[model samples]
Target: MSTPAAPALDSLDLALLQALADHPRVGDLELSRLLSVARATVQGRLRRLGEAGVIRGWSPELSAAAAGFDVAAFVSLEIAQGALDTVRDELLAIPGVVEAFVTTGTSDVLCRIAAASHAGLQGVLLDLNRSTSVVRSTSVMVLSTLIEPRLLPLLATTAAGREARAPAYR
Candidate 1:
């Protein structure tokens, strides 16, 4: 069953979310202690947050280097008009193609792909070119990644803004 939808997040909700993200392995009991809330409150918020799609249940993180697919690259492709879905389907069929996006600018779509080596990447690129709708592609190899995915800082800023707006209660 789904929890009733929340129009927007309150500061307390953000606090609970931040606390959970900071300690992913912690249970509701521990969360309550960490956030200074009742255990039941933590449980309720988690349930609501999950149902609201605020928390997509945890997924295991994978490293391409550890998996032996070290080569990483982003490819921009120009596709025939009205054929994005078809080309996307073809790109998804390639095992090396990890993710894709439709974006603005010179190219119609962009994709992130990985390979075991330079030769493997060449094979993947050739496969990408075989799509009937894809007319051209430009690939850029990733030298290194400096920043990884993150969200805590944004949550903190939003939560602080909400707190500042709250009036002193009677």
Candidate 2:
């Protein structure tokens, strides 16, 4: 069966999420004060959001470049038929591989890798090319990041839409 749809977020839920996003380290009391909601409401909403898988984690985001991995590249792999699981397992063993996805069209798998130097990047490429499951591969180095990863803007837009649809009395 297909998965059930996630419950829709009201304006208050959106506001709470925005508050948390802005101040990830802020406590429930502060959040309640900022949103003009009860502390219990903040706690209950956070609990519910966490339970629903909306709030995945509170971990700090790390920068690969700051950690000595200065070079980044996107590698697309064409794997042997029925070898996706095997390839996935093998990729997990590679330290430089940050993210990977099974995709459509020309490539079967797409991976983002980080390395300390061009030589290190070459070594990682050699490792991928050595894999028996990988039939072909293509890659491109990232020159610069134009936009940093973000979610607050999208959340704000969602909140605005929800508010616009609400009845005047509420």
Candidate 3:
């Protein structure tokens, strides 16, 4: 079954979200201290937040450059009309594709690919061009990454606010 969508948050929920944003790995006790709430409250809220899918999970950020995947490319694809599903599925199956999204404007899909070298990127580009659903593609190599993945602002706060008034909790 699909997970239920998370509810919205209020101001205090926003505060908690901001606190977590500052330190995702902080313990409940530390979070309580930072938010000036009870430790039990923090624990309970965290549990609810996780169950509601507001807090997906936490992990340390790793550098691709350090890991030897120095080459990055943003590839824009023009998919044949009504073939987005086939194209998206194929893109997802590609080994080097780190992210993919359907988009409006000039391109039907945008994909982020990372590889250990330029040769690896070239192979990915060639494979994309050969895909049956892809009409054309443009790849722009990334010189550097200014920002990586992070949580959406106010996600936790919105969840907290909704939990506060949820009938089940009440």
Candidate 4:
């Protein structure tokens, strides 16, 4: 299915979003100064934008590698026809399966798994392959994560716009 079109944003909104992207924790006063808008206007815009669902709440990014989860691997799965549901459920139940996506490629499911060591990852891979519903799985261990950023460029723009609309409190 096609993605829904995003609402049009004015230049001011775009500027606000960009500013927020650069610094999510930036207060309304600072944002107001940066965007050259009144603090009250910034607060109002931010509230409106959030209510519209354009700006979701912020979250912190954690590093799995630094937190003792050194092993990272992508498991590509091919499940038996009519067994997709069962396979998906079983995979989700497995601990350390961080993310899973049902896709239209050679693999029916793509999963990102993290473990403390290579041995731990091996165990998970073996368990997946042994499942009757899973016809086959290809595991690719991550040697290194080259590009994983906390924020995307579009999000910065969106957040700035939303913050710009936050209500100004005297």
Q: Return the top candidate by lDDT.
A: 2
lDDT tens digits by residue: candidate 1, 1-170? 66666436666688887776677878889999988989998888888878878787877668987899999999999999999889978987999999899999999899998999999999999999998899899999999888887765776676677778889893
lDDT of 4 by residue, 15-51 (tens): 7777887888899999999999999989988887676
Q: How do all models score by TM-score?
A: 0.85, 0.90, 0.76, 0.70
Q: What value of lDDT does candidate 1 attain over all alpha carbons?
A: 0.86
Output the lDDT of residue 160, model 2.
Answer: 80
Cα lDDT, model 1, residue 169: 91
- Candidate 4 minimal-lDDT segment of 10 residues: 149-158
RMSD, every candidate, angstroms: 3.2, 1.9, 4.9, 6.6
RMSD of 1: 3.2
The backbone clash count of each candidate, in order, is: 0, 0, 3, 22
Q: Clashing residue pairs, candidate 1?
A: none
lDDT of 3 by residue, 1-170 (tens): 98696555555567777788778778889988988989998888878778887777787766777899889999999999999889878987888888899899999999999899999999999889989899989999999778766555536555666677778842
Q: What lDDT would each prediction earn against the true structure?
A: 0.86, 0.89, 0.82, 0.82
Regions more than 4 Å wrong, model 3:
1-6, 149-170
Best by TM-score: 2
lDDT tens digits, residue span 40-150, model 2:
999999888787777888898799999999899999999999999999989998988899999999999999999999999999999898889999999999999989887
Pairs that collide in candidate 2 are: none
